[model samples]
Target: MYDIYSNAREDSWRFTLGKCGKRKLLTIGLNPSTATKEKSDPTVARVQKVALNNGFDGFVMLNLYPVRATDYRTLPSKVDEEAFSENIQKIEDLIRSEKDPVIWAAWGESITYHSFFRRALTEIISRLTLLDVSWVRFGEMTASGHPRHPSRLAYSWSFSPLDMEGYAHSLRP
Candidate 1:
């Protein structure tokens, strides 16, 4: 839809991407990469494969942060309050109306990458708490209990249920 659902023309940040269907899989990564509506990076391609293979009509790519950095290690140590606020708002708009929305907690180990990342996820989960959202995980949760990222695997696996709210609360320093 619209090549891909995105908020800006620049690549520094991506609030949302992917085409929405009546039933779509919403994937949340740590941050955005170089992919756009015109092209897909490895991770986005992997997401599309997982969604379609598992019978979803479409997929929506979201992130804990919108900032685009190829290497997450390069992400700012300090959080940008405005960007964080807008990110939460955009996420609400994307998922608020869906009936029984299935969210893929694909952030994996990145949840522990920084306190800001964990904080961002908690805010998003707060909004989803009121809705009938079911969180799913693609493969295995890491040793630390975080869902695995799509880009980490080569084969698609059927999603397993994840205790999203509980998982979010467990993200302690």
Candidate 2:
């Protein structure tokens, strides 16, 4: 098993490249959790299961913030601007490298917890739109109006391209 946090240092970003297949997926989430000895976080496992069921052989996981905290509420109040910028660049590079992957908008409702995180998400979504990458909305949206997170997705479901225009308009400037 590959360790996602192998190179991680205190307060630094960390990510794992999941199993690969012919049909590719890119998932953007809030942040990673500390993976234990055997299994990954339930959220990660949920994403993998859905991808495989939807005919996506593999997935590459990224995050809005790469800091490894179990919950967004536990994150530090101050956002690391430099790390956030670098992580965004890394995600963009990965998207550019992949061949028209189905990018899953799986950040869930965590965006509401912090203004800085929401802003970062909006910026990333804008970049995705500019690049013409597809956004996959899984199942129904939450009460907050964002797409359902992987863990919250319907047991049997499919993904569709999100309405980026309307979504962008909804974001506070």
lDDT of all predictions, in order shown? 0.82, 0.73
Q: Model 2: how far is 86 from its true place, Å?
A: 1.5
How do the residues 64-98 of candidate 2 rate in per-residue lDDT, one tens digit apiece? 88777877899888988876787777778778878
Alpha-carbon runs more than 4 Å astray in model 1: 154-156
Segments in model 2 whose C-alpha atoms lie over 4 Å from true places: 2-7, 10-12, 36-39
The whole-model C-alpha lDDT of candidate 2 against the native structure comes to: 0.73
Per-residue lDDT, model 2, residue 44, is: 78
Compared to the true structure, candidate 2 yields what TM-score? 0.87
Model 2 weakest lDDT span, ten residues long: 1-10
Clash pairs, candidate 2, are: none
Error of 2 at 83 (Å): 1.8
